[model samples]
Target: MGPGNRPLDLEWLEDFLALAESGNFSRAAQARNIAQPAFSRHIRALEEWVGVDLFDRSAHPAALTAAGRRFQPLLEETLAQLESARIKARAAHDQAAASLLFAATHVLSLTFFPQWLGGLESQLRLGPIQTISDSFHACEDLALQRRVQFVLCHGHPEVPGRLDEAEFPMLRLSDDVLLPVSAPLAGGGGAMHSLDAAEAAVPVLAYSEPSGLGRIMRARMRQVFGEGSSVPTLPQGVDIVFTAHHAALLKAMALEGRGVAWLPRSLIAAELKSGALVAAASAEWNVPVEIRLYRQRADMAPAAEALWTLVQERPPGSGGR
Candidate 1:
């Protein structure tokens, strides 16, 4: 409410502040980019709205009255709060427009996401990105619940997961291989653990059920080995030493010469090259998998949609490392 109980014009508040700061009507009018008479009218309207005089006109420098002195601080505080609210509202809108949200499995988040995002940045402009790295099931849940724009994880066409079952749109970004690897023996002669060993039961570092790689390995191992085989088969038997949902965790245990573990080739390429980790089995045991990005079928943010378009335009193996 304002003078005559009409709505107040926000410009009048600005005029009041300007006049209070300058302490001169003409100077304040010039500062506010309005004519002197118009600015004076704005100040008068504001005073009427407040139901009191705000300036002592007889003072040498047009000083504030006691009421004006009290009003100045309250007005300054109110204006400051409104400006803050305006800034926050704009910032939130901008963030919603420019931000990208992703949920990636632990392995891909570490081994693949940074490089893949760098490659995309070269082709398109991306804003702030938020990535959640967790187990496959967690990433799947984010995608299913519409909490993120994309999910990056290993997938096999033969073994469809929840995202696939829900018919979420996905792009096969790259190819990856999960292969058996073991730390080298003490004398550096060969791998410490071997799938073909015929001695005591072979120790195995395996994936838990929550891991996407675990699901793929279990399903494919059944096809490669007999119907009942879950992990890679040893000539004698396999003793499950440890189970985890993270490939990097299994890689650490494998590097310590703990047991034979199936790890992604991309993740252990440096180790394989340096002979820190060696092939525990032949190439026939390697499982080929796809590094896939899944998203909801509905429209997404502009940046996400643009990224998906660029990925589709590129060649199949261009982004794989």
Candidate 2:
């Protein structure tokens, strides 16, 4: 006999099970779409391998031997399991192709994801996908409702715990950089050098609601500027002042110098590199945030798996500004 612990050859096991069910070599051969002689040879091989007589050839209409009778249930169970496995494999290959939904905060979504996704889309060969852009809270609601496969957003209290419930990990998807920026000064003089020393009236534009970056900025402001000195609403002192969607827009306003804008480094890399924009602060304590991705814990479908792999394959060190 073959090594007792060796895994069964499924194809041979299946042929044996079919032959047992049909009870005739010719009929079993027809069911399997093979020649009768070939079927007989296969069964003989199986019997020799198992070291047992499976059929009583001398009997009319072919009957199972005592050993065959004892093996019947196990053989039938194995066939049934094989059938179930085939169905599941087919589903994963076809019917279970993943439909995808992704949401991101405005800044990261607007600034870098287009390029990242352009790279990702080239790899996906299957399934429908939808990407939503909205406030961080909206992403949360969609993720909670199972409307989206993943959410991309900045820091939030719900974080990894929220993803854990769905059996997904919160991956640090990108490194983002934040900077204070302003348009070229009128006399070609550089803009504000210090948040305090600069004209206090220079309106700092910020989000109207408590948002992911909004909360971070609000807390940091209080800690740094003393209590009750937060910059008031959008365009507070002038109509041209700062504010808008993610940091991309925030950085855009900074380019015009309506007021100082805090924005991601990736958002302004082009301008910064070309000398069109300037970094706001050099202090490491001045900026901290990251872009993140979330996925479900259940068996990931092909499309989701494809996207997940593409997202992970990005070169590391892309900042969460």
Candidate 3:
């Protein structure tokens, strides 16, 4: 077959390059660790494929013919390009293997993920990470669809979410409290709103339906008050003046004295500490919850698996890193 139609072997190209470099068939064969006859046949086959005599056999040391000379630079460049392509392919594969993907509820992503990841970094060498922060429902969809390796969010055992129903493996990373909080009263005396207020309806900054926290809060409120009670089931009636999918947003409104919001202790710790916010209700009104991480049951990339292993190894109540 002519060069255009021939099935060219890559080894032949390598052998040809070796021979051109050494200019001696015997030495090139030795360098290639191939039998001399086999090496000569490879060169002959390559030359035939190219439709030209690539080497002047009569030279003191075999020399490239005019066509071989032209072929040499092109072959060298082609080989270099192939090697580059090979390296880049391997690098891309390694990066993908080492990378970790996560979906987190917006509040935890902002308030918890950074410190937790930093703690893990102290123990393991992690690769690239991409975290998608969205509403709880969105994060659950990502996890259920296997679009992310892990999902981080709040959970209450009594109020199991879709991930729980799906039987996705989970780790309770830490304990958190969902408690009523509000901006400090004028002159920083006390909370601006109270769960025990006897007179007026308490203005509440509430979570939207899409929020995982909203689900847990609603269920827990029903259990605490009574199944017969309606929404905003606190002992004292409430008026939900604002609703949002993120605790951070509710917190911002609370700071402005807008209303009381049941926010995660982790998210409002700074506010509570600095007196920018205060408990709107007593400890009896607090709802206990878990900071949970869930993963698909299917096999994951090595880095993700390793993270799961580390999380499993941590002692119960040890804040997950």
Best by TM-score: 1
**Candidate 1 per-residue lDDT over residues 1-321, each given as its tens digit:** 346775688899888888888899999999999999999888888888888898888986778889899998998899999999999999778658647889999998888899888988988999888889999999998888887889999999999999999999988988999988999989797789988653877788889989999999878886332366644555577788899999999999999999989899889999999999999878877889999999878999888998888988987668747
Q: 1 or 2, which is superior by lDDT?
A: 1
Which parts of model 1 have CA positions greater than 4 angstroms off? 1-98, 223-235
- lDDT scores of the candidates, listed in order: 0.87, 0.65, 0.87
List, residue by residue over 211-247, the lDDT tens digit for candidate 3.
9999987787863323653334465567779989888
Model with the higher lDDT, candidate 2 or 3: 3
Give one digit per residue, the lDDT tens place, for model 2 in 4-80: 65444556676787877878888888988889888887777677677888889988667889998988888888779
Looking at candidate 2, the ten consecutive residues that score lowest on lDDT are 231-240
Instruction: Report the Cα lDDT for residue 27, model 1.
Output: 96
RMSD of each: 8.4, 12.5, 10.6
22 Cα displacement, candidate 2 (Å): 61
In model 2, what lDDT does residue 191 have?
A: 58
Residue pairs in clash, model 3: none
Q: Which regions of candidate 2 fall more than 4 Å away from where they truly are?
A: 1-98, 121-127, 156-168, 192-196, 199-202, 224-245, 282-285, 309-321
